[model samples]
Target: MANHLDLEEQEQLDQFKHFWKQYGNAITWVLIAVLGSFAAWNGYQWWSKRQAEQASAMYEEVERLIGTGDLVASTRAFDDMKQRFPSVFYTQQSGLNLAKAAYLSGKPDVAKTALTWVAGSKADTGLAALAKVRHAGLLIESKEFDEAGKLLSTDFPSEFGGLVADKRGDLALSQGKSDDAAQRFNEALKLLPQQDQYRRLVEVKLAALGSTEAK
Candidate 1:
């Protein structure tokens, strides 16, 4: 009876060994792939958190520099921060601030550069669309009529239709197309919600343009 038990145990061990020999490498690799992916995911989350913290600190520094009203120093600091973390939320916001600062400082070229960078970013599509709209306005101010027209004609998301139409009207006005401008502004009025203060602003523009309906 003992000999019979030994034979049975040996047979089971042999069967297991055969099975392992046939699939050991594939099983090992599958486990490694699964575990490796989990580890990589955790590492990426940690890295992203660290980067965001660093970027937030850098953005605060840039804000301090801007607040000092030292345009040259602020611009340099902003440049450095953007180079390091172009896709970070803080970096994107800093770009918008820099654009406003530069434009207000009569540095349209620098402002355009900042706005262009923000507009091109894919990290935040909503911010990017806002940047594009602002950039189009600046281009119009610069009398880059063709470029402004092209930018204003963008197929913006539905939520931004009113803003886009308003911009298009501005572009038309810049090009001396008053009738077209009125049409676009009226379109904006229809697209914009009644409660949106921006819609009131558009109404003002339409009134100024003598759109009878806007009256």
Candidate 2:
């Protein structure tokens, strides 16, 4: 009976050895892949967080320059932030702020360049749409009527429909198309929320165009 028990234990040990020989390499590779992916994921998360923190610091510097009314310094800081962290949210925001500052500083060319960059970038869609609208306004100021029209014609967020219509009205009015301007302004009025101050401005435009029903 003792010999039989020894043989039974040996048989069990041999079966375990056979199983390891058959599947040990595949199991080892599977574990290695899972562990590698987890390590990679952790590394990516850490890297992304570090990048965001650094970009945030740069954005604060840009904001400080803007607050000091130093357009040149603000632009330089923004450029640095974009170069280093182009995919960051703060970088896109810096572009918008820089464009505004450039425009107000009588640097329409700089403003347009920044705005165009934001508009064409893979930033947030709403921010991109806003940049396009602002760029269109600058184009209108420069009498680039066709280009402004094209920018306004691009698809925007639903919330921007009214603003886009108003821009179209401005373009039409600039081109001496009063009827079209009035129609577009009326469309803007319909699309705008009741409490929107911009709606009042559109109403004024419609009134100027001999449309008494803009209220």
Candidate 3:
């Protein structure tokens, strides 16, 4: 009976050894891959959080400078934000703020430069379209008529299509295309939703151009 029990134990031990020999490497590799992936994901989240926190703090600084009406300092801070955190939301906001200050301070060229960058950047498409519209307006004011027309011609997001049409009207008028301007203004009026407050402004533009809605 003792001999039979010893043989049973040896058989069990041999089975375990066979399993290890067949699957041990595969199991070990699977565990290593899972652990490595988990660590990589955790590291990425930590880095993203750190970047957002740092960007938020810098945006606050830019906002404070803007509140003080320090256009020069605000410009510097905005430039720094653009350089250090170019892909972040705060950088785009800072660019817009700085453009406003520059334009209000009678620096139209500077305002146009900043706005043009935002418009052409790989930032959110909606905001980029808004920048393009504003930049076109500034160009019109500067009498860069042809360039303004080109800016207005670029495709924008759907929500801004009406706004783009309205700006195109302005550009057409500047180019002495009053008939074309009237047509664009009429199109803008129709594109705007009934409840949109901005629709009234477009109506006024149409009226100024001596155009009425289609009967």
Tens digit per residue, CA lDDT, model 3, 87-203? 777677777877898899899887887898788677577778888999999999889998998888788888887898889988888888999999988888878787889888888
lDDT of 3: 0.85
| lDDT ranking, high to low | 2, 1, 3
Scored by lDDT, the top model is 2
Whole-model Cα lDDT per candidate?
0.87, 0.89, 0.85
RMSD of each: 1.7, 2.4, 3.0
Tell me model 1's lDDT, rounded to 2 decimals. 0.87
Q: How do all the candidates rank in terms of TM-score, highest first?
A: 1, 2, 3
Per-candidate TM equals 0.94, 0.87, 0.84
lDDT of 2 by residue, 112-205 (tens): 9989888877757888898998999899989999899888888898999999999998998989999999999999998999988888889889
Task: Give the Å error, residue 198, model 3.
Answer: 1.2
Superposition TM-score, candidate 2 onto the true structure: 0.87
Which candidate's TM-score is highest? 1
List ranges where model 2 is wrong by over 4 Å.
1-17, 212-215
**Clashes found in each candidate (C-alpha, N, C closer than 3 A):** 0, 0, 0
